[model samples]
Target: MKRKSAKKTKTEKLGLIKNILLIILSFLISVALWFMGTFKDQTPVTRQLIDIPVTIVGENVLTDKNLYFNDIGDIKVNATIKGVSTAIFSVKIDEIVAVIDVSSYASGEYSVYPTLQNIGTAVTTTKIDSVDIVIEDIVTNQLDIALEVEGKPVRGYEARPDLAEYESTVSVTCKASIMEKIAGARIKVNVDGKRTAVTTTTNVELLDIDGNVINDPGIKLSVESVSVRLPISLIELN
Candidate 1:
């Protein structure tokens, strides 16, 4: 009876050991499959991204020389990128920046090549189209600054410029073509419903030959603002 009991205990121990071995073998197989699936090389993908913005790097190079771009023809491009599927799909439109360096070039027209940046190493830029750009030299000019009063003063009051106290001259720098178009600079003062003299500082505006305001970002003025004193007086009715 004791020998039969011992034989039964040995059989139970063997069964338990076999079950544990099976479980360990299954776990190892699962781990190997996961590692193979996660670390395997993926197929390369090619994507054509369009209308990526072309930026001017070292724009200060031109600005410091008192020069500016007259025409940046076709300031955008289509990019062809080749990379692993995962990386190409994860890229954002804004993440790609196309830049053209004009630092070494002077004021003139030329065909420039643009380079891409911020794209990860997993991806490679295959192709980028070139662009034509024009840079122009800026010219300086001095013009007489005038003050114009807008809106009628309160009833029985007249507004006039205090010619004795104001900035009469302003120096302006801009492209030569633009400089030729500028007729003068003026500061506009509003005198609505005012019976007393109005004294304040206001921004000056560049005007074309026909008195239309010239709004050119490339234009630089020595003084951005000016002080004005609009002398008001009682109008004696005759």
Candidate 2:
């Protein structure tokens, strides 16, 4: 009985050793697989950025009456990259897009986002050093036009309509800079609702696209209203 018990003890010890060795071997194999996956190859990747929509809001635009605009869909920006095969495989195109916010711009010119900014120039240390991008505008029309007037007198009496830098119409539609001053604006006057020539001191308004008046809000006119000189006898008429 004593001999049998000793043999049993030896067998149990051997079994325990075998189990520990198997565990260690399995762990080593797992580590080797992980390392291999980290760096398997080196190659270039080309991905497409599809329909990345963005919105731009701007102020002081004219789009009413005869002027209008049609908003286009969100813009699309694409890029092609080259890098390590392992890193490239995990490189997500969507992740790259997550770094840019171009929704604050209006219908005009703008530069690409600088955060995920593609490498414009390549260096010797990196596989892919630059990125190229194409940006487009999404256009929309807003109906709020403001007309501004500007022009100085020849150098004498004040201007009647006060044409020295003021909004003509509440709004009009055109390019931003073009809306400042319009050409060929006129003002007509008729005394006593009759087509007669009369000179008097009165604050009248000018014409705008909305048919509003620019009163004599303290801004003096270099040229006064049209007038006709009258004789003393005519001035004393009953």
TM-score of 1: 0.56
Write down the lDDT of every candidate, Cα atoms only.
0.85, 0.38
Any runs in candidate 1 off by more than 4 Å, and if so which? 1-55, 70-74, 78-99, 115-128, 153-157, 162-164, 192-196, 234-238
Q: In candidate 1, what are the lDDT values of residues 1-238, reduced to their tens digit?
A: 9999999999999999999999999999999998876665376878998999888877788889877776565578988998887888888878788998887778778987688877788889888887888887889988898888889999999887764257878999888878888999998899999999888898989998799999988788989998877788898888
Assess every candidate by TM-score.
0.56, 0.31
Model 2, position 29, has a per-residue lDDT of 97
Clashes of each: 0, 16
Q: Considering only N, C-alpha and C atoms within 3 Å, which residue pairs clash in candidate 1?
A: none
**Cα RMSD for predicted model 1:** 9.8
